[model samples]
Target chain A: MGLESIPVVTQSASDGLTGNAAAVLREIAARLESLAKEGQSGIIDLGAMPLSPADKAWLADKLGQGEVEINLELDGPSHVRETRYAGVWWLLHHNPQGAVTGEFIEITRIPELVLAHPADIISGSESLNFLIDDLC
Target chain B: MREQEGRLVASLAQQGISRRTFMKYCATLASMMALPPSAGIAMAEAMASSRRPSVIWLPFQECTGCTESITRSHSPTLEGLIFDAISLDYQETLMAAAGHQAEEALEKAIEDNKGKFVLIIDGSVATGLDGAYSCIAGRSNLELLKKVAPHAAAIVAMGSCAAYGGIPKANPNPTAAVSVSDIIKDKPIVNIPGCPPIPVVMTGVLAHFLTFGSLPELDKLGRPKAFYGETIHDRCYRRPFYDQGKFAKTFDDDGARNGWCLFELGCKGPITYNACATVKWNGGTSWPVESGHGCLGCSEPDFWDGGGFYKALSMPANPLKLAAGAAVAGAAAGVAISFANRAKKGAAKAAHETTTLADLEK
Candidate 1:
C-alpha cells in the first residue's frame, strides 16, 4: 500500500512570507550598507534587486532598482516630538505567497532617539534600539 | 486458591461496575494519557493484580477550588473512581481524621509509603513570612511539601496553583509561593495545571503511571502534551470565524451572539494552549469558549501574568511589517489583476482576427 505523510497544520499566507524571508532580507542589508557609505545628501533608491530571483527578474523587466532616498523632517507619532533620526533603513522583501502577498516593506535599522519624557533619564536606551531580541 | 484472587473478588464485589465497563474506562483513561489500547489492558491487569498505590493529597495556600472542582466532576465519576484507581490513603481536606488525628494520618502515610506511593500537591507552597500567611500543625506549607516530596514515587503537581504558583505568584506576590517543580528538583514532578485541572486529566495521568510504571511524556514545563498539544485556538469551534476574519467587535455584538471569533473581544485562545476546546469540561459538555467568555489560557505557565487578553501578541512579524507589507501587496495585486485583464483582452482579439480571416475565405 502507498503511504502518505499527513501535514499537521496548513500555514496561512502570512507565514509563507515569514518562511526564510531572512535570506532575501540579507541582500537588502548589503545594498543599504553600500548606500550609507556614500556620505552624501541624496536619495539612494534600491529599485533593482528585490532580494529574490523572481523579484529581481520583475525589477529588471520594469522599474530597474528604486527611487533615490530623501531626507526630510516629518511629523512623528503622538508619543515622539520633532526629532531627526537618520538612516531609518527600510527593507523590502518579495514573497510569492503572502497575506498581503508579494513585496512588503519594514523599517529595519534605527539608532536610539531618547524621548525627553517628564520622568527620569530612562537609563539604558534599550527601548529605542531597532534590533530584535535573542528570542528571534 | 490464592489470596490475590480473593482480594480481587472482594474489590469487584464491592462495586456495581462490570469488568467490561472497567476495561472501557481504563481504555478511555489510557487514550486520555495518550497511550495505546494495549496500555489500557495493561492498566486493567495492573488494577486487577497489584495492591492499591497509596496517595497523599496535600492542600496548601489555596481556595480549595481545585478540590471543589474535582469533587464536582461528573463524567465517569472520575474522582469517585480514583479510589479504585489509587489508595488515596490520606487527604487532609477529605479525610475522616482531623486535628492531631489528621496530622497523624499524613505522617503514617509518609512512613508507610516510604520510597513508594505518589504525592499529589494541590496548591502553591508559600514560603513568605515563614509561611505565616497560611499554616498547618504550626509548620508552613513549604515544610510539608519538603517533608512529603522526598518519599513520593512521583509527584503530581495539580492545578496552576501547585504547578506555576497560580494567582499568588502574580506581581507583588505577598505570599512568595513556589511551584512543586521548584523545590522538588530531585524527583520528576508531573504538572497537570489548570485553574483546577480537568478531573479526567488528573485521573488519566494516574492511569498512565499505573499502567506503564512511569509518567507519560511531558512538555518543557512538565505538562502532559496529550492534553496540551495545541492552542485552544487550534481546536476552538470559533477557529473557522478567525480564518474568515470574522471577529466579535464587542462583548454583545452579532459575532459574539453567533459564536464567531472572540479575538477582538480579548479572547486569549490564540495564545493559550490547552485541550479545553477538544476535551471540554463537565463530561465533555462545554468549555468556556463554547459557553460565552474567551479562554483565559488558564492552563499555561503564566496565564496570570500575561497582559490584557485583547492586546495583540507581540511576536516578531516574520521581520516583515504586516501593515505596510499589506499596502504594497495591494499595489501588486492591482498590477497583477490589470496584467491578467490585458492578457485576456489580447487573447480575445487574436481569436477574433482568426475567425474574421476564416469568414472572409468562406
Candidate 2:
C-alpha cells in the first residue's frame, strides 16, 4: 500500500481513562494500606493498584476501533494481560483470600463498566500484581 | 586556566570563528553540561584560558571498534578534534613511537601531569592467567593499569569493552574480564558504554568536562544520563505500533514491511536504554532497529549475557490481544458506513419530495 493506505485514529489520546479506573485504584490502594496496618504481609497485589483511567479508556477505544485481535491470557505464574473489543475487558484476577487461581472467575468491567476495586489485597508483601498489556 | 583558554580562543578567532560564534558554541556546551544558560559566558572564558589538559589513551582487550566509531563522528574528525581539544601527549594507537620510546613517552606524560590529566582506557582488563590474555610491551594489562591510573584526574572508560567488559565479560568469562570501575577506585570514573559509544556523546562529555571542569551527572550505571536517560523504545517512531498491538513476528514477514513493532522478533528496545532512537547513528540518520533489526540493548550492563538476541521476552502483553477485536471494529465500521449511506439517501429523498411539491405549485 501507499502512505495514505494506513487508517489513522484521529481521536485525542489525552483522555483515555475516565474517573472509573482512578476511583477503583484509590479504593484498592486505601484498602491495602488499611490491611497493612492490621498486620497482613507478603502479598504483592499489583491488581489492587489503580489502573490509569486514561489507559483503560485508551484500551477500550482501541478495541472499539483498530485491526489486530487481542485477548487476555492469564495462566500460571506471570500470566496477565488487559484488553477487549466491542466494549469488553477480560481481566483474570484472584479472590480476597488470594488462594483461588483460575481464568475468567470474575469479570471486572464492561457495558458502561461498574466496578469496586477493594484495597485490602494490596496490603500484603508483594501484593501489587497486575500488569496491563494490550493483547495481540 | 582562563588565560590558557584565552589563547585557544584567540587561535580559534584566527581560524575564523567570530567572538559571537565562539560564545554560541560555549552556550551549547554549557547547556549540554546541564549548566544554566548564563553559564555560557563562564564556559567561554574557561575554554579561552584553561590550559590544555594532558590525556593518556590505553588500548586493551578490544577490536578497535571504539576508535572506529569515534573516528566516524563527522562533527569532530574524532582524531583531529580530540587531540586539538586536549593536550594528547600519549596514545598507544595514534602516537608515532613504538617500543621503549613509546613506553617512555607514556611514563613522562603520566609523571608530568600527575593527578591532573584525564586517563581514557579503551578496553576491559583481562585478569585470568596472570593477565597474560592482553599485554603492553613487556607488562600485563593489570600491572599497567594499577601503575598508571593512580595519579589521573578522571577516568573515561571509552567502550563497552572497558565499561562492562563487553563480550569478554559475558557469561563463563575465563579471562575474568573486569570493568574500569572494578579496577580504579580513587578517581570518579565515567563510563561511556556502547559496543562503541555515540561519537557526539563521547565528544559531548569531553566538551562538558573541558568547559565546566567536572564530569556530567551520571545515571545509576555511571553513564552520563543525558544520552542514556530514556529507553530507545520510548522514543521510537514505531511506539504506536506497539501500543496498537501491530507487530512483526518474522524478519521478512508482511508485518515487517508494513512498519509494525518488532517486539515479537526479539526486539529488546523495550528494555534497552540508549539514545539509538532519538540521537540515532551516522549523524542522526538511523539506528539498527530503524534500519530493520531488533535492539541489542548494547548500552545496558551485561547485555551480552542477557539472553539469545533472537528470543524476545513475552513478559509484556502484545498490545493487540483478542481475535474478536478486529472483527468487532470491522463490524462497527460497516454499521457506521451503512448508517451514513442511509442518512444521505434519506436527505436526498426529502429534497426530491420538496422539488415535486414545488413543481405541482408551479
Give the whole-model CA lDDT for all candidates, comma-separated.
0.61, 0.63
For candidate 1, the TM-score of chain A alone relative to the native chain A: 0.23
Score candidate 2 by TM-score against the native: 0.60
Best by TM-score: 1
Instruction: Considering the two chains of model 2, state its CAPRI-style docking category.
Output: incorrect
Return the top candidate by lDDT.
2
List per-model TM-scores for chain B. Answer: 0.82, 0.79
Local error of candidate 2 at residue B73 (angstroms): 1.1
**Interface DockQ of each model:** 0.01, 0.01
Model 1 lDDT tens row, A1-109: 3223422222222222222334444544554465467532211223211233454444333332333342221111111111122333332321112111012222223
Model 1 C-alpha RMSD vs. true structure (Å) is 29.1
- Candidate 1 stretches with Cα past 4 Å from truth are A1-136, B1-13, B76-78, B310-362
Off by over 4 Å in 2: A1-136, B1-7, B10-42, B77-82, B315-362
* Per-residue lDDT value at B34 in model 1: 54
Models, CA RMSD each: 29.1, 26.2
